[model samples]
Target: MKILITGGTGLIGRRLTLLLQKKGHQVVYLSRKKENIKDVIVYKWDISAGYIEPEALENIDYIVHLAGAGIADKRWTEERKQEIIDSRIQPIVLLKKYLQEKNNSIKGFISASGISCYGTDTGEARLDEHSLFGDDFLAYCCKLWEEETRNFTPARRTASIRTGVVLSREGGALPKMMLPVKWGVGSSFGDGRQWMSWIHIDDICQLYLQCIEDENITGPFNAVAPAPIRNAAFVATAAKVLKRPFWAPAVPAFVLKLLLGEMSAVLLGGNYIINKRMAEELSFNYQYPELETALQDLLK
Candidate 1:
């Protein structure tokens, strides 16, 4: 299969590309940078200017739309928020327009959606793909992103992997979570009862591979681990795995609000997201099913 991946230089995209290649699939990246990498072909695209190299789309059998501004990268000012929305929405619009113009119909369109679309949970309960849409900034952003993806209807099949906090040793939330624990100054945000629906990075990539190949697996599927842990438990597990002490008190919610503004929602609140559809229908056996085991393997 010939796959064209947007934002292929990102942590998830970079790893996903290699995994696809190992399976004997041809992978090309649409990047902002045009640097020559060994076997990987890099094509350039200017999102703001609405331009992408036409060759990138030629002979592309599958497209994994991973391109987007990091939600938690900066404070969510009005400008930053628009950037987040545009970064996700514009890419979809651009891709659809280009594919239509070329009369290209791919096998499927796989995109990266966030579990935050379920919104911050007020109570600890298992949430699924059918859960109510989150009304927060992250949720709103995800909705718009996914909505744009729907534009490819009647022409191409699509699958949106509603991903959770992807745990990775290279990058993602795991490294930041490990840092405080390593210093023995680890703590949780707020009361620490907020649910964290997480998945091992390997599992996330595997899930994407499944979405790419399986035509029946369509719509929004929660890409998360089976066990959902509390923020406090998450902190303790990281501490235990790192062989460090957890002595610090929980960070006050008010302090976090003052520090992060609207972005505090990502840390201060979380959903009890479950991979019900993915597990039962797709039968995805997670590489790291439990939090402690995932931590031990990554931290060790």
Candidate 2:
């Protein structure tokens, strides 16, 4: 099988590409410019200019869309918010237009979404994919991002992985999280009771692989682990894994709001997101379901 991956340089994309190649599948990347990516071919696409390298679409079996602006990378000013939405949406529109123009069809379309689709602060309510869309900025952004995936009617199967805090040493939230823990000043955000739905990096990549290969999996699937830990417990587990003390006081919500602006929701707010469809409906096996074990593997 040959696959085309957008945002292939990202932490998950890079790891997923290697896994695909190991399974005897060919992987190509869509980038802003054709660069020398080790052991893979990169094709250029300028979403702003509305041009995608024609050869990139040649004989592609599936598309794994991981391209997007980082949600927590900056303060959510009106400009940054638009950027976050457009970054995710424009790529989809471009792909759909190109595929339609060439009359090309792929077997599946896998997209990246956020667990914040159910809002940043949903308290302890156990939310599923069928739950109401979130009302916050993050939820609004994810809603728009997933809606754009509907354009790919050519792909027989379309699915969106509503991802959570992906734990890995390479990138994403874990490294930044581990820093304070390593220094023995680890603490939780806000009141420390907000739920932090998380998953191991390998599990998420495998989820993406399943979406590509399995015909039964479709629509939005929560990409979270079985156990959803509270913010304080989540921090405590990290401290234990790093062999450090977890005695620091929780960061006040107001301080985070002031420091991060609206982007504070990524840390100061959360939901009890359930991976029902992915775990029960799909029966997907998790490589690291326990938080402590997952942290130990990444931190050790």
Candidate 3:
């Protein structure tokens, strides 16, 4: 299978590309910078103006859209919020338009979505496909992101993966969290009881592969581990793995609010998202099922 990926240079995209290649599938990357690489094609595009070189879509069997501004990149000023929203929406719109104009025979369209759509704070109720959208900025961003994908008229199949907090050693939330914990300053956020749904980076890549091969899977499937852990549990597990102290009291919510501003909602808020559909449909096995085990592997 031939796959084209946007944001192919990103954390998830970079890893996913390597996985697909190792499995003997062809991978093409869409990026602004041109670089020399083996066994992969590079197509350049300007995302802001919505222009992708016409040749980029040729003979592409699948599309994995992962381009977006990092939500936690900066304080969520109104302007930064708009950039986060546009960075996701515009790329999909451009690709949709390109697909429509070219009338390509693309087999599957897999785009990135997030569990944040369910809400910032979901308490103990495990969120699934039927969960209600959270009335928050992150929720609004994810809602629009999924809606854009729905507008595409691809020739074969379409899927939007509502991913969880990915556990990767290279980047994302894990490293930042580990830094403080390794220094013995780590503690839980807010009440330390909010649920956090997460997945191993390896499993996340495999879920995309499952989407490519399984025609039965579609719509918004939660790409998370089967077992969701509370924030306090996650902190305890991390402390155990680091051989650090977990006795620090939970960080006050007001302190987080003062530090993260509107973005603090992400730290203070969380969801107990379930990968019910992914498991039932694909029978996918997770490489890391428990928080402790996943943390151990990552910490190593």
TM-score of each: 0.97, 0.98, 0.96
Candidates sorted by TM-score, best first = 2, 1, 3
* TM-score (C-alpha, index-matched) for candidate 3: 0.96
Encode model 2's per-residue lDDT on 221-267: one tens digit a residue: 99999999999998998888778999999889999989998788788
The residue ranges of model 1 lying beyond 4 angstroms of the native Cα positions read none
Instruction: Give all candidate RMSDs, comma-separated.
Output: 1.2, 0.9, 1.3
Please report, as a residue range, the 10-residue window in candidate 2 with the lowest summed lDDT. 148-157
Q: Quick one: best TM-score, which candidate? A: 2
**Per-residue lDDT for 28 in model 3?**
93
Error of 3 at 13 (Å): 0.8
Q: How high is the lDDT of residue 74 in model 2?
A: 81
The lDDT, on a scale of 0 to 1, for candidate 1 is: 0.87
In angstroms, give how far residue 281 of model 2 lies from its true place: 1.6
Tens-digit lDDT string for candidate 3 (124-159): 887788888888888999999998887767647788
